[model samples]
Target: MWLYITIGLVALLIGIAIGFFIARKYMENYLKNNPPINEQMLKVMMTQMGQKPSQKKINQMMQQINKLQKK
Candidate 1:
């Protein structure tokens, strides 16, 4: 019984460690493929939309985006 219990605990710990590593790797790849938006990207987008992107407007949009994400 003691041997079984020790083996079970070790297996559980190993599984948890493997899961953590897999999840970390997945997130790294995901971020690499789809990086977070930045001011430069936003400026390009606004320009494409035919709007002149001013610094103040960019800051305001960034703040609004942050607020939405926080919710």
Candidate 2:
């Protein structure tokens, strides 16, 4: 009886571990394929704000965005 109970518990743990890893990997791939934003969107936003964006400014903003996302 005790052997059966131990085996069931171990199986449950293995399932949980597999599920966690699969979900983690899927999220990582999703984020990699579809980031939250890009340069063109930033440029459009700045243009809408009535400021012509320079490449330097755009690059700076991109760095800031990437830094924030890392946190």
Candidate 3:
């Protein structure tokens, strides 16, 4: 009885560890090919969060980003 309980607990722990390992690997691979956030996307997200960005400010930031990309 006691041995069975111990074995069951060990199996449960091993299953949990395997699940976590596979999830981490999957997420890492998924993110590696994805691009990070851009200015427009950031502004949109901020707006959704209740903060809006002005058009002039967004343009200025985009111009700076373009200049950086040209370098």
Candidate 4:
């Protein structure tokens, strides 16, 4: 019946919402523990580009990256 179909749809939606939240939380935690890029990687990239990355520059870049991720 139509009532059964409605209940099934509702259940499916609830499952999807729960899954989304769970996945989002997991990714946030993973990113916090292991950032996408680290200071070493940044230095490597800068060196590759023929630029010596200073500590201040690295910290600035890290702050910017963190801000972006938070947004």
- The list of candidate 1 runs beyond 4 A from truth reads 38-41, 44-71
Candidate RMSDs in order: 5.4, 2.7, 7.7, 1.4
TM of each candidate vs. truth: 0.56, 0.64, 0.51, 0.84
Clashes in candidate 2: how many?
Answer: 0
Q: For model 3, how does the per-residue alpha-carbon lDDT over 17-69 read when each residue is reduced to its tens digit?
A: 99999999898676555535477686997699787788787778777865674
Name the candidate that leads on TM-score: 4
Rank the candidate models, highest lDDT first. 4, 2, 1, 3
| Residue lDDT tens for model 4, 9-59 | 999999999999999999999999999899999999999999989999999
In Å, residue 63's CA in model 4 sits off its true spot by 2.3
lDDT per residue as tens, model 1, 1-71: 99999999999999999999999999978865764877899999999999999999999988887677556
| Backbone clashes in model 3, listed as residue pairs | none
The TM-score of candidate 4 is 0.84
Instruction: For residue 13, give model 1's deviation from the true position in Å.
Output: 0.2
In model 4, residue pairs whose N, Cα or C atoms come closer than 3 Å (at least 3 residues apart or on different chains), thus clashing, are: none
Question: Per-residue error at 47 for model 2, in Å?
Answer: 7.5
Q: Is candidate 1 or candidate 2 better by lDDT?
A: 2
Residue pairs with backbone overlap in model 1:
none
Candidate 2 segments exceeding 4 Å error: 40-53, 67-71
Per-residue alpha-carbon lDDT of candidate 2 for residues 1-71, written as tens digits (9 for 90 to 100): 99999999999999999999999999978887888789999999999999999999999999998888778
